[model samples]
Target: MATTNSLLLGFLLLHIAIHHSVPVEGHPNYSDALAKSILFFLGQRSGKLPPDQTMTWRSDSGLSDGSTANVDLTGGYYDAGDNVKFSFPMAFTTTMLAWSILEFGGKNRMSGQLSEARAALKWASDYLLKAATQTHGKLYVGVGDPNSDHACWERPEDMDTPRPVFSVSSTNPGSDVAGETAAALAASALVLQSQNRTYALKLLLAAKDVMDFAMQYRGKYSDSVWTACPYYCSYSGYMDELLWGAAWLHKATKNATYLNFINSLGANDITDIFSWDNKFAGARVLLARKTLVDKENSFDPFRFQAEDFLCRILPNSPSKTTQYTPGGLIFKLSSANLQYVTSITFLLNTYAKYMASSGHTFSCQNVLIKSSTIRAFAKKQVDYILGQNPLGISYMIGFGTFYPKMVHHRGSSLPSISSHPAHIGCNDGFQYFFSGNPNPNLLIGAVVGGPDQNDAFSDSRTDYNHLEPATYINAPLVGSLAYLAGRYGSG
Candidate 1:
């Protein structure tokens, strides 16, 4: 009897060893977790984060005493730390975070990252509930600093005197707020519902109010006050994001109204951009292809837009372009643009769907190779940060230039052409750019610059006074780092 038992145990041990020896693709957990982690980290790595210690949505009272009201207007405000607070910018950021987290967590659970997955689920739940409760039936441009004595509509005149009017209005709207906010809320509700049916249903009902408000106002996208101008509208270059939120809402509620709304926007309006905005469109396109393709939805605009942009930028070959720099650093440019990594990644995942629906393939291997290059570049940038580079001067690789500043354009502020680091104003604020990299190894992203060197933004002149982390730069970093750690761990 003892000999027989020993033989059985030996056989069990052999079976386990053989399982461990199999390749990762055959290991369901390995494949799923890796995919989830990569997707979440990629999405997060696209945005900026706050420079100051305080979370963006916290009551403004605790902020530094002398901090300017205009500080909230800077891009960093959109990258606020906590998801519990729901303001306009926070709402947008949180929605992106929640979707990524939930998706990652679900994959993690399947891949055996149970604890981490649960934490992500919990964070998403708390955020969605808080956002739903705070907004109730109405969506403002975003939440205000709770500590401020001013009303939601109040704006400061020249950073000193406060005006009675609210800078954001639910009615008489201006920027992409109506579309962007509504889409975010709707997506959040849908995700929550998929996870927790009861809670999600309630949130969906509440979210309908916000959607209704947005739908009631069918004004031109240019009238959106939340963003700066027509150039910033989702249609100008980011219709995908608007569509992503809308698609999720459509899926969650199974509401024909949302589908009809999206259909009316038409595909011709979608523009191709390299940022997450384009991913949003890809995501929605996938959703639409899944749920509405058979419902007589028009395909003309989507085909035209996809062909126009994809054909124009699709690289003919995987070639690298180099430019000489006065500095020792080598700038790497590819046939594919780095800025379009987010959109390209989305397309990679969803291309089959588009092909089936539209009979066109946006096959651009350069997009994928460029993304890998950007990931490599991100590692170098992070190294530069940890090395104590002053004022966090980093380059976007392909451009061979430092971050651009907001310059006055047609009576409004817009990101100017990329310039050298030595030209950036207010070098103090640029240091935050060195925070994290896109690699699984956090150290890989460290900035290698020496401690004392000053970049362009460091000037004590007017440029310094106007400099701050743009929202586009900061939110993605925070989201990406957290997503990476949660998904892939230190490896």
Candidate 2:
């Protein structure tokens, strides 16, 4: 009888989530969180800083990024605290940011962050437009050398590092990076469609061209550009990117060919995870949208895969994967753990919305899994990120009373160009890097690579694994924050 009562109570909560937003007690101001998350991009921006750029500490740098190759790869984003502009993860970041607006754009609008989101997205897309169209059948994978850049810790403005232009062509194949970029362009195109149709069409065309390159010349990007190895290597291979790219292309154009491509995906490629390195799970979740919302029976396999992932993530399910900290944080990896937490939570919130709005109930192990429970779990994780954890620290910089000040970012650590106009040599900035003091300038809004399995964080600038903030870590998080901000409006 006690077990029966507990089940009934769970179901009641789930039912409420379907009809109303679950009142997440102690959730930090989500709208504020969203605003701050968007602000992080301004700090991460590469190339010429806009006049209105709020991250004043960040100055124009990497202006001559592709000059060696005589191609202008000036924009996009820096991959992490280090200055390399790796296309694979950079493209993934753009896709997630655009996806956030696509999912909860209305919420951003209400919270007055829609334009900021679009602008931040445009910064990357504009760079992508330049990067992808540099040559026909050629896609530049990265700019700047990670080893050399890591050797010297200087501001992007003051550094005189060797900027080597890398690419994957018909001869040097890299389907993964190409396909990921295609997906990014397609996702961004969708976001810009109603806002700027002409630009959207231009992006859609670029996506098609890149997707063609990815499909025709089949190979891993990291394989072609050996430099990217040991860093952003293609761990799960190129098949996932090809499928993930096709899904986004289908989304942008409703092209049946792309759908057929996704439908024809191999069973081996199916998985229940999403990350910069792997998109198999993200692909499943995206394709499931069609099966659930559009009622496309052909995409049923992906829908089932999506449900499997949900069951594992939802703790009450019998077959659930035990991947949580004692504090209820969805801990996956020890290093940069929040990446998994944010990305997985985004899917949970996304699927929850899809199910609730479509009036579909989720079942696991012959038990009902309410959309509310999924989102409630998602919210709990987000709250942990925003200062409800054992550490009582907000992992997202600049959102709460206390955040990590020793963010492992070179630009943020050194004095701004405006302050210290004197040139700091490429290698002379090690003093700034090793300093025990907090970063001179805050990397406001950067979602740092978070805590250990025990929910403990080492807030040291030297602790790159747990302290370094990356583009990929913050991207999917933008979508999650926006959705929650909208759900818990004006509160």
Candidate 3:
């Protein structure tokens, strides 16, 4: 006990020393720290607490949600600040997580995030396998009752609410969800292939089956289920998922059919913004990478669409598309806008790396999308999220000294001390309560819903869009930050 206490004291002192070293009046060098922060964020949002994991802040979560629908829904990551697990976005996040590791894991492996990244991805992949196999060909798309889950403000570990599960069948299709899940499984197969080839093949076969089901059915899940609307809805339509799933499937397995399918689609309706709901941007990037890196001249048709889309996102395009804040964040929707910007940041960094490697300059309408330009824009976006913006506050939790304290996350807001013991659970009734003080446990590394157009922000628990953090928001940031840190060396 004495030795342990001494070690703890030493660690605390070291932390304080490093904390004081951060520049008081400049953009703090938090790239390395922020990379670790992203891992912590994922760890906290994990559904099932592993034995080796040490998340003292979060009690064993998603235990009650286990065995819902008589299926073991025990090993996926939580969707957002809420306890629910929407498998569509959850799988999307997992796909990005695996992609980050595969594309940029070398430096991260040295940085100690690779293990956490693998564990996080495995957690979701395991759940996806169960979700796929339990119901034969059809996959479980959505888990948890968002209506019931959101009604209570308690932690996932303490919840006694209804834990219902939802799925997609051939008669009732969910192309977006199933396609995204296939993308996740396919991407994860690459990550796991070398480590465990047997399991990797299982993921591949499952991905093939899931993709086949999704393509064969060909309809958005949100249209079929009223509960999935507006929250985890497919805003950009379902065709994007078909393209996205094919792109991933092609990447996982060098299949000529997947390439032909994407080629037949022609110029994709360019949605300038991308998110969990939208996979067009992701699909375009993945296809472009394949075209550039392939030793053979296969998938060469994708080069045009990829270059076209890339040029649109970059500044100075003839279109002059993509709105930006005064602080320089690529703004899309007013609600929780950082999610959109961070997603773009990750994509830009990825394309930039690919462009740099290809040594070929891309232009659209005579506006050059050079490697330097892409890197500069991506770095600026990253800087804004850190502390370089007008507000001079980092959007990420537990990074800079100043960040959102009253985040609109139930898990972060619940009182550590029970003022009224009887009112702990939503047994009698419930009223949405926001704690007056800062969150008791720092949801470290969480990138909250960020500032407004004019760089205004309120650290109020009532502001849901501006304060709540989600896994999708942080997932890209992890990959983005890792790329930046590996390229430039963390500050």
Candidate 4:
């Protein structure tokens, strides 16, 4: 008991120190942060590099991704610091990016990140299209072996590791991954409608086919692709994804079939999160719009659930499920906590607009709160991520003068090909992974797994739980940063 208490006391004292040497502020160049966040994806890019590839550090990688499956599975963002291309999170990344564009695209343009954001969205969407269509009634859920890839720390550029492709067919259905891909296609279609109407329509139609497959052959992708377990497993079940995909289909196509399916879903549980694994919260948010725009009686449950989700996440609400740190960061799971922060902040921005445009107010524990409050709370959280915390460091790489230098991304850690022509062998890369030095290449815009419950951060490459960056982490943040920059910041 004394030891535990002593440890606790020591932690408290150290936390109070709060890295005072590191200067920090509430806001610093939101536009710059937005741009860097978009650039982060370039570092995670796999397969062939384009001529205009800005992240010159990352060259062509995983070119023969789907060669094992005899299908082209090149050109998608890596799941995280690793080279393995997990399709579930990749689809969620696309869906969130598209949703951001659909909501705050103008703000993104004002902040001078619209084109990059569009390209980022297209980059993932194009791969999603190929994933769903290339398999011929089958869905390619993942590429590369997680166990082997994780064991070796080499950069994707020279991946000598096994490039096994995993897919789910009618016999082995993966509703979760397929549904997510469908959602990605639908949302991307809406976002890219102006850029290429014909392509957008093609995406919408493909979304329909994939969504139908998900509904027709119902099963979890994790079940089919067992290797994905303990990584990107489907925790909340496949129904949430099906409903999410159906909602996006309705939004894009406005087909009565989709509307009927959503109304039939009858998911009343207020989702606690919107992340790579769970889609319930996102489904509620999207379906809520149906009642607002169409004034449909069938969609009232979704609106109620969506409102409940907001109330549950708010600090003032009696039913609040999300916990906040002393530094005002949204503290959820102990690991990769920033994923929830980004997801919820995006939803708050989206739902806040919905409430403001409709002049609607909701009762949180019978206390009617203004939509502005949610937006304000969201800003505080975003500001906390940029800085304004006890740690006084930006979780986002390249956002501030002092940020994460030891991001747990393999490409960022290894010496760039330009700098060192000598190849770092497979296991040899672990030396860099464990090194205390900063990564050789800057993973700009990459949002790392964030601080602990006490708003403490470890700037160690070995501490992947708190230092690794991901594509999904940056996807939802694009619009939030863009909106803040447009509405408030000079940059």
Candidate 5:
């Protein structure tokens, strides 16, 4: 009996030594720092924005106010029965910022920014926790302001209800809730674990439950919903949310169920929803490449399809160029659609990694522009902003045609007005248009211009100086500028 026990002990020690010695797969330089930053930040903080930055944007108070400060509008307009307001877009922004901070830490450890990153993580986590608590496990994806009547369904009046000041619509109900919540919780769990917080395990378990619940509601092919309209379907958003959640869960728990879920989703046909207007399809493809990189299973057809779709959109030649002008400043779109700084950055950073691993390139013409170009564009945009006065940079430009076009309202008995010209502006351009004809849906925000211009402006020429500081227009603009500044730093 003694000899048998000794043999078992020796085998167990050998197994442990081997496991410890093996380098973990997917150990990218950025991932380690990201993990550390997220863990540290979560352990140290809780609800509320850090004491440094003040919320200067407009508030959505009173019947006359049409804007909500610091919030992104997803499901616009609301009425009665829909008493809840979904704040997923705002939630998403927070999640992305938190993820960005962690990812950035993985690559470059900027000293002073650690606190800012920590603050962002804390703010986002609090927001998510509050949302979860408010919903009480019943997912309310976004928040709505009172003015916009809920037109999400056929009968807006029937669903109208007075609850919070914000509006809640069923249009794109809970599409990203599960994925986003999972990401927030996963990040928090990682942050807490690193600090040796006793509750880290519990947070992780809770996060897993949220993720599982979300997965259960994913569409037939495992694609996530953006809204009730099929056109609003998002490719990259869902995939990123899912992969990030799954990857973190797998890493933390090593559970085969999560791995299997990822594989099943990967194998499904997700490209049927692709459209030219949104680059979400492209983004999803890139995300899929990231998710499938180290998997042992044969490369999924959807993964290849995603690559093929990207190839279809690629400019014919690397040398070919397009032009972009915004706020009267002209720039060259040397890489076609690849000009969008964030999109290009994601492609190069992610797709390039995939190319290196697969020993395959998506054709020479389709190769992502180098990281240098992305950095250059970001820098140029930053320079333009710094050159202008704070208010001068307030405009937001609308890009694709799918974004609503401005229509002049005559204020006739028929209700609202229609038939406005479709105009594109620079990143800073802002335009207000109805969500639908006859009745105003809600004013939505969009970024304009093709890939090359450094100038950002609104589609309209009117001076917005008279607009209230607390207006909705200012909040997103502020957030966008803040995001851009963070990405490129003050030039």
Candidate 6:
């Protein structure tokens, strides 16, 4: 396997040598390119784009969904490959975005990404404020029914289907969604604190109130809307999110109450993997950050657990549980597993940097764990996604010369037509899921569902699970890419 990997790496380098413009190695301007990729998703927003955003492909979409339901839902990002906005995942994406900005936004301020990130942050943060600050603090979880939105292939701006809204209240509780939103707002407050102190305080106060609501009334958002289970289900329950929200609040405000809540949990209470549903690993990472950077030993209670998490995910750790693709991606699931790989990559990369900054060192499997080693491991995953594997194709659209043209996305695949046209050519090529034709519009910087466990990838439009791109995936990619560009000179 080592010999085969070396041969493959040689071939990939040679391929890039011949095709200089390919995004494999020595690609200059990756920082700017990655920043643009993040902006691409923000521009794909269904509602109004901020003044700084020069959006063209999509106009106002699902604006009336708020008016019809008498609730403000004019902002927030569209979920993967569809127009429906699932608040649970959307809020999680916002929290990650804000965290990324808070972590590395200062390093690449000259790239103008800081401004773009701030725009994206405020867009989602403002929408979250609206969602949480409703009558009697009821937070809406799902906007636009998934079934109704998936029934037809129409632009979000032109859809005529019922855009139903779902909410979580004291009677209908949703601790997972509520807690994640609280985390998002809390992190957003930190992102905005330097520039807009007033807005940041407003977000923090709201986050505290919302966290209280989530803890006081505990349940998953999917309980209220049964249809949301298959899409944004809380498989790991709400305790992780509650702790996660409290952790972020403690970090942002340094309040002892929030710190007390986090210290109350057991050290081994965390799960290894971090995702939209699972915040245990992420909360641990944040806690570890506080311990290392702030020199605050007050987090002594979680010190052992944080060290355990770091060791478990390391390449040579005895407790390493994450499986890898044959081509070397940290695989977790069977389908579109690259999303999980990329998300975990950011965490590992950030944690490694934290360790490096603090001059921390440890021995695993007779090999010393250093920041450079951890970062090198994280960089391998980035290269794999950008055409270093057996398939040798970039999963992120418009990054490399070769990529998937049929990315199972309606907005990019369907023709842009004005006016509401019912059943407009819906049956034209629905049968042949792998449309021979390229997508009508180019969704640049949009990374589609990635390859399978065996490094097998089919660039087909029919395979939604393997071709769809979600905001959560892109959120982590932004941070990882930024960190890479800063650490290793782009191009």
TM-score of each: 0.47, 0.93, 0.90, 0.94, 0.48, 0.91
How far does residue 405 in candidate 5 sit from its true spot (Å)? 22
Give the number of the best model, judged by lDDT.
Answer: 4
Model 1 error, position 155 (Å): 21
Q: List the residue pairs that clash in candidate 3.
A: none
Score each candidate by Cα lDDT.
Answer: 0.35, 0.85, 0.76, 0.85, 0.37, 0.76
The per-residue C-alpha lDDT of model 2 at residue 435 equals 84
lDDT tens digits, residue span 1-491, model 3: 99999999988866653454434343445466545555655444546565665545565666655476787777677776777778888888888888877877775432667777777778889888888888775678766778887777776556666777788888889988988999999999999887899999999999999989987897889887666876788887788888998889998998988778777766368667778988887888787776676534565556666666667677777865777788778887888999888888888888888878878677778677788888889888887887667766778887766777877776666643233333368532224354466777667778888999888998888788898888888877778777766655646
Q: What RMSD does model 4 have?
A: 5.5
The order of the candidates by lDDT, greatest first, is 4, 2, 6, 3, 5, 1
Arrange candidates by TM-score, descending. Answer: 4, 2, 6, 3, 5, 1
* Candidate 6 residue lDDT tens string, 186-261: 9999999888999999999889989999989988777777758677888888888988899998888889998887
Model 3 vs. true fold: TM: 0.90
- Name the candidate that leads on TM-score: 4
Query: Where in model 2 is the C-alpha error above 4 Å?
Result: 1-26, 107-110
> Per-residue lDDT for 277 in model 5?
19
True-structure lDDT of candidate 6 = 0.76
To one decimal, what is the Cα RMSD in angstroms of model 5 from the true structure?
19.9
lDDT for model 5 comes to 0.37
**Cα displacement (Å) at residue 96, model 2:** 0.5
Tens digits of lDDT, candidate 4, 407-458: 8889999998888778888999988888888898988889999999988887
- The residue-by-residue lDDT of candidate 5 on 1-491, one tens digit each, is 99999999988866653443311221112222222222222211212213342321111212222124223222222211122233433344344444444434332343444554555445555445544444334444444332332322212212222333232223223434566566556666665465546656656766677677566655311132223223223434455456546655665577888767766665333332221112344335434554456554443544565555444333433533323354322243332221233333333334444545565444435455433333344334422322221223311212111221321211110111123222222211122222233223212222222222443323221211111011111111222233333443432
| lDDT measured at residue 227 in model 4 versus the true structure, 0 to 100 | 77
